[model samples]
Target: MSAVIDIEELRSQFLDQEFDSQEFVLKTENILTVARASGETRAEFSDESHPDFQAPPALLCSLASGRHLPIDFPAMGGIPMDGGKAVTRHAPVRPNQTLIGKTHLHDIYDKKGRSGRMILIVARMEVYDTDDNHLATADSRMVIREKPTS
Candidate 1:
């Protein structure tokens, strides 16, 4: 019996799979580096002791999983695209503090496109402090586009 496999089933294989936690200390140099690039000069982020010196929110992207998010979609003659992402900040991440992050497969859904079906994979990343306090949660969605018919 040959039956087409659904993308949800493929994703289930990785739903229980988890990645190693990544831990790193947020250095002031990095904060300033991003500040210079993002033009975020509120003194709190650039200065170490400005009474509200906190690491830039976007800096949390560095703590994201370096490896690809666990998603094994069915065969598709197409390439994956950025598709954009949505990040949510919990507690403020401070400078010079070690932060630990863990990522896992969160959700997967599909939609019909003009060319073909488009599958969207959403992976969640959670970051915490050395003390085990949750700091932030980031969910990134990537879309796999089917190759348009000639």
Candidate 2:
């Protein structure tokens, strides 16, 4: 059993409020290491000396904020599960670039699942370079649902 979540209340209190922020200095060695580990075969991502050498898109996943949600999460009282993440790239991320990531509660909503009701929370993190150029946006989803009784 779980307490009912107040979607409207959560939205008003948390939406767009920054919860976590982090800074990362992209290094060629680290980027290449991640690329190779992820089995990326692209020369641009694996070869630092290549003219188009760039950080693999998957590298942004590692740059996510330390915390995904606000410290004071809503009192939904349900089993929370990771709903994965979606990343949208606006510009290429290059090595030696200093990037900042700021995360916030983007949205909260409910759905009627097969077993019961489920609440979905979305945390959006916007990434920018030292020059303030938008680089990417990562939306992490979390799902809350009631526990089944034996």
Candidate 3:
């Protein structure tokens, strides 16, 4: 199998490049929903006007951060897989506040496995607040598997 795009070119075009930051407002309803679904009894996650209303830890990176992808993936005609994500929280994420974050292509490469040629693209995102205080970083990896030819 052959790569759909030049691997090196993809890296040069995306890696370490910062994109425009996007704002994600932590709605009260969403926070409450997640807290209830997670079987959490803490009022911080559901109480919008509470002074301690904080976002659920697991929801920090759940704001569709991929919407800020720095680069667009070409049609590779391959199956895509969510390789998972790693997040390092630097501060508490709260609700009823606008959060700003941007995503960048952190790394990209290709590999050959028993299934076929696989391409891995990793994206890194930094979340912050209106004051520009860093809150967390999440790295999400996506894998593309080459399509089988008849």
Best by TM-score: 2
| Candidate 1 residue-wise lDDT at 60 | 77
In TM-score terms, candidate 1 sits at 0.79
Instruction: Write the residue-wise lDDT of candidate 1 on 16-128 in tens digits.
Output: 46655677788888888998899887998877778878877778765663644644435554565766566677788888888887888677778896777787777778889
Please list all clashing residue pairs in model 2, or write none if there are none. none
Between candidates 2 and 3, name the one with more favorable TM-score.
2
Per-candidate local distance difference test:
0.72, 0.82, 0.77
lDDT of 2 by residue, 1-150 (tens): 444666888889999999888888889889989998999988989988888888776778667635777888755667668877778989888888788999998888888878987888888989999889999998888898854443
Query: Which candidate comes out best when scored by lDDT?
Result: 2
Clashing residue pairs found in predicted model 3 = none
Ranking by lDDT: 2, 3, 1
Q: Per-residue lDDT tens digits of candidate 3, residues 60-100?
A: 75753455345465667766677877788898787677888
Per-residue lDDT value at 61 in model 1: 67
Worst 10 residues of 2 by lDDT: 57-66
Q: How good is model 2 by TM-score?
A: 0.85
Candidate 3 ranges beyond 4 A from true positions: 1-5, 41-51, 68-73, 148-150
